[model samples]
Target chain A: MPFAPALHSEWLKIRTLPSLAAGPAAVVLVTAAFTALAGLDESAGADSDPLFASLFGVVLGQIAAVTFGAQAVSAEFRGGALRLSLSAVPHRGRWFAAKALAVGASALAAGLLAGCASLAVGWAVPGSRAGGPNWGEGLRGVVGCGVYMALMALFAAGLTALLRSGVMTLSILVPFLLVVSFVIGGVSGTAADYLPDKAGQVVLHSTSDGALGPWTGLAVTAVWAAAALAAGAWSVRRRDA
Target chain B: MTSIDVRDLTKEYGGRRAVDRLTFSVRPGRVTGFLGPNGAGKSTTMRLVLGLDRPTSGTATIGGRPCAALDEPLREVGALLDTGAAHGSRTARDHLRVLAATHRIPGRRVDEVLEEAGLAAVSRNRVRTYSLGMRQRLGIAAALLGDPRVVLLDEPSNGLDPEGIVWIRELLRRLAREGRTVLVSSHLMNETASFADHLVVLGRGRLLADTPVREFVHARAEPRVRVRTPDGAALRDLLARHGYESVAEEGEGAGDRWTVRHARVDDIGRLASGAGVTVLELAAEERTLEQAYLDLTAAEAEFTAMSPSRAQEA
Candidate 1:
């Protein structure tokens, strides 16, 4: 069968599965809710970057992206799901491609919606309206929020496929993204800047001190996602169902 | 009609061989029973045929093409390797729809199979709520959605009730009758014997017997004669005079029925007629398929449950 039908079938699977569909919806709710709460916080220095402060909820929202991507790929490793899928579409490459497309497209749509909702709420705070709709760095950050989250999701998906598990991916990632990059990197040095999550999030910062710029950081993240996806694809073809 | 051809196929996981140099061909218009003990590699061989697992050597093909090479595999072969492979969250109809969408199979075919497998009532319910037997029926429904020419079922009768067993037996026979190749695996020798036209017995990852069901039972099991007459004592005395030892069955009607070992029905009939004894029934009592299977596997089987002492020693 062609890739169109395979993609359609995968889309149906995602829609029919409540947990699978919840991942993306959670991104919008959590990101928008947290960003709105942060908008009410009054303890802010005059020199502080307000956009970064308001958009900080992305740290939590991106986890939802990771979950969506990881669960989508890891689901195949559970029970006999892989066997049934492969039996339906014998070509391993086509199956993986359809899965990657489904995950990427879903994350993209969710990320864009969450980014817009969070940005609107962030702008709603009394101080954020002081210089409203700059349409320069502010617009870029909003768009970048969507792109960065989507990339994070795809990255998680590719890694999940390589590991052939959702729990293992989440266990390693939920900590690395939430804690290690912030705490350990705080005491350590510039190494965190090169990590996928940290590097990808560079676009969220209006002004950053780093050798890599916003687009370059995303490009680096894209490379990582590509490499991981290649490894995952190779693993799927090489391993026995 | 289609055929499944496995040629010198072998599979090794780690260092242990799972399916060793197995070669067999299943032809259309018949139900070929794939019989084996637990871990005898029946599932593994079927996986190889479906291209779910790569064979360490050789190839298994359907209609002269590897399963992987088929552009539309569902149209060629329908296989049931794992019944519960579906996600627990999806409904029976949803599960079939997703699979069918890949091959563009219509929704009507899905309903038809749901009805055929007796799963139409619960088609909208989640798979997690279905019983093991119901899950098996859904799996069968998925297999039939594409109108396949060859069907490979692994332990298709597992977790089914007696009525379901009879249903599957008739289904396989009917599928074979329609000239579709049907290969079913089961440890229940008696149940398989009721439907299987041919037998493929495996033991310790090797082919032990691959022949017609009738020929296999006759070759492996003992042939006995059951004689029922009004004068059982006269029949026994007459048989003993001819150096034929006989014993009555252990039941309420034992006095009326005598079981003669290593005897032919024709000989017993002739002897009974010469003796002028009234005979009601005299027929060859062929050993059941289960007994024949045990007899054949006794020499080929390698694994058996360990006794308490053996376990302690190990």
Candidate 2:
């Protein structure tokens, strides 16, 4: 496709990290674990859809996205290889764009596999008649989850560039996504709706609550992703490698 | 022809000036050695040229264009900032292949570079498993993958063994002969002295000397004639009469022995013969590059007196 060389280089980098393997592996394991949990629950209910129950793995799978996002740029900074990478591709903005594309593609692929596997396992289990969630809606949910994961990864990448430390990036992101959202949800009723996880999870629901339609939630997540990516791009372009 | 022109390049790190008004040009088809002590801003200058660091003032351009302006930078300039900069988990071949993919270079080119760098046997091995010398070779291979017109290497010999060092020296020379601009930086004066045709010497974040290697050696080196003779005092006196000072040999049983400072070989022979002292052996001792470098940077040495920290810093 004649994409920037930096993009190809970044894809190679993403594939090489031990953490990259961990992300997809985490997706599969978490999906299977959640599917088994849902299967064990005798009261999964006749009304409960298999897709929703099995796709519960998305919650845990998002953590993998966080890891992928952080490692995408954080590893370079930690290894002091940013200088080398920047030397290869001098245009800082273009380099970041390439990284975003490569990281996004990987996250999408992994998220889809996890989402599809969870759905398949849920449908295969006994006594779970709940299957029909409209093929289009289900497709949207799967695609949205992948996009959400990719965005989360980009968000993490930005935070890593700003923080410039792997531990610090993870420390800040984990709490914001996992803990702070829960705390805010408990403190204020409507705050969770705006949180990234909350907004992203809205895609999984086949029926729309008046709060935010599925597409609207995806847009909300996209806004968060765009903001984080913009901030990351700015930092990468302005700061010394 | 690909030439690197750096004009008044200055890079400030917070309050500290990493590179202060550094100006120099690396011409095509020459091995230009960048010489400096630790913290003399050799790496910083290179970073500026590659556009890895923003210059506070001035500019560094490759082939009349800023590095950032190049459409396919690797095809024009290949740089090795660090030998071990690749991801540890990736194989050496994969690292090179990924870089090759960037410029749409064929896979065959990657294999060629691997063979050229003598890394074909271990191309499949993980980078982390390679020794420092191997990593350096891999980096050189990556730099040469695009058949670049200009190659910028920073301390490429830092971790290499004697054989590897010689290999790099020959490789650089060959590359230069093939019309590529090869710029290599090193703090080791002797290493560059034998290999470099031109030199850009730096001290204390400033340019100290930029001249042909021959000129630098000739201007700074003071050749002395070494003689072994029983009547050393008579020869020393005869040389002293000709307006030269001599320092007596300082050791036990070293009777009447002395070494004259900066005495030319012909002058010593003539002075000894005129004084009736039979010179047992007389030969001109070519001044080593180490001596010349020490004399050149004595005043601006970062560490006036050596210590543990200085050793660690270097």
Candidate 3:
């Protein structure tokens, strides 16, 4: 509660950057676009799982989300603004907490909107009822997707803190998510299930026969998010701004 | 009283001592200029005082409490260390609003600062569109947003035009007159010469001098008397005989002019009149702040000798 001012300041900072809006916009647009494209494939059938098909947009949307999160902190260091921020708020720990809360909350809200829209568009297509698409399940999926996006943002923040460079954070995270995770999935079935993206995808499965149950998959993604955030918090408090 | 007291503060960057045994007090109601050359540790000292950098030894306190202990730091001490600190994509008004939010300051204060900094016309423009001088003004506006008791600005005139420089000098004087402690750092002595009332001079992580600006300038003053006479040779000999040191001119117009050095204006006048040399024009030349600064730091062997000691320790 006492950090409300700091949080408010961080929110204002995050919202004003064009990248913040542009990045989230990409998430929503890509989610809708991908769902629309998937909907056109008649052979894919309308009876296929609509939530999973629509949720595929996150594959691209997460990239923009991660970029926004990483730059939230990295841009300050790059522009030599961290010194000014630290001078205004001497307590590094409190500043870090406020930044995390602001960035994470924004990413979550954007992710939820993108997820729900994508699912609705995909399910609206003719004969696309893979499951009941119950409102409760749909709500849970949307909320879980939002949580997943927030966790990924936190993960990016942590990586940026550890590396202290925008390019380096992206270089490592992008390849790990896009290429390495896929490669591992192809080589070993079960091992790939624990990769962040793979674990996060568990929330999209409406049936019971997925690699991980919905809650179990969220817990797996949460582990990665927690570890990254913990590492970020420690480094932010210890290292010179 | 609102003041910054740095006591025996020390900062070590790995093996190098960036600031050592630094002790000084900056009091309110005056502009205290922190003067030092590049890498002389002026910024490091400020960072330590603001609690941005952890000191290796000792402590710095604001109003008898450490800067870290302040519940609302912006209200207590406002600092403008970097001009490009705000996100470039944000509008000038938004940037100030964010900083103001940290102190629960009203949105109207943001507009007030925008007007004060002469940024009202461009408040809606993104910071990336601002020139370096505009950015510097924005930074100052942010520092003043809280109406703090103490204001710290590092190299505030680094990128200002002549008019902007004059504006900053007047603004600082007005702030100090209002009973706020204003600490400004600059490598150029001439920049702070007329504006600063007190000075804390540093060289190579050591305090070289801490005194009133006028006294510092006066004590190091080498007032000279420039004399132009029809018979320059006669005037030189006359001044030499009167215990005044004269340096000969070396050009086409050099034959009729000579510079006689003396600390006292009266002595130079008496010597010129007593020697029967027609004084074409007699004026006591006051040393510029740059000249005085050179004289003050020229004799400082501690900084020059630091490299060898550091090499030995390594």
Please list the residue runs of candidate 3 whose C-alpha ends up more than 4 Å from where it truly belongs after superposition. A41-50, A126-136, A186-189, A208-211, B250-255, B301-314
DockQ of each: 0.79, 0.52, 0.60
The residue ranges of model 1 lying beyond 4 angstroms of the native Cα positions read: A44-47, A127-133, A187-189, B228-245, B251-257, B275-281, B302-314
Give stretches of model 2 more than 4 Å off: A1-6, A16-18, A42-51, A127-137, A186-189, A208-210, B250-257, B301-314
In candidate 1, what are the lDDT values of residues A1-241, reduced to their tens digit? 6899999988988888989989889988888888777667666555545566556678899999899999998878887889889988999999998988888888888877887787787887665535543557667777777788778888888889889998999999999988988775543237777788778777777776776788988888888888888888988888888
Candidate 2 lDDT, tens digit per residue, B26-128?
9988899999888889998998898877899999999999998888888888988877587788889888877776777888999999998899999999989
lDDT per residue as tens, model 3, A1-241: 2688889888888877787757667767776667667666667755455467667677777887788788887877855577767666667888888988988898898889888887788777663555536777678778877888888887898778777877898999888878887677554347678877778877875654556877888888889877877888788777766
Cα distance off (Å), candidate 2, residue A72: 2.2
| TM-score list, all predictions | 0.93, 0.91, 0.93
Which structure among the candidates has the greatest lDDT? Answer: 1
After TM-score superposition, what is the CA distance of residue B301 in candidate 1 from its true location, in Å?
3.7
Estimate, for each residue in B1-314, the C-alpha lDDT of model 3 and write its tens digit. Answer: 79999999999998788898999999999999999878889989988888877899999999999987788888889888878787788899988887887778999988998899899999999999988999999999988998889999999998888888999999999999999999999987788997999999987788988999888887887888776677777877777777878886653552466677754667766776877767676667877777777787886754465768654743
lDDT of 3: 0.81
Worst 10 residues of 3 chain B by lDDT: B248-257
* C-alpha positional error of residue A56 in candidate 3 after TM-score superposition, expressed in Å: 1.6
Q: Give the docking tier of candidate 3.
A: medium
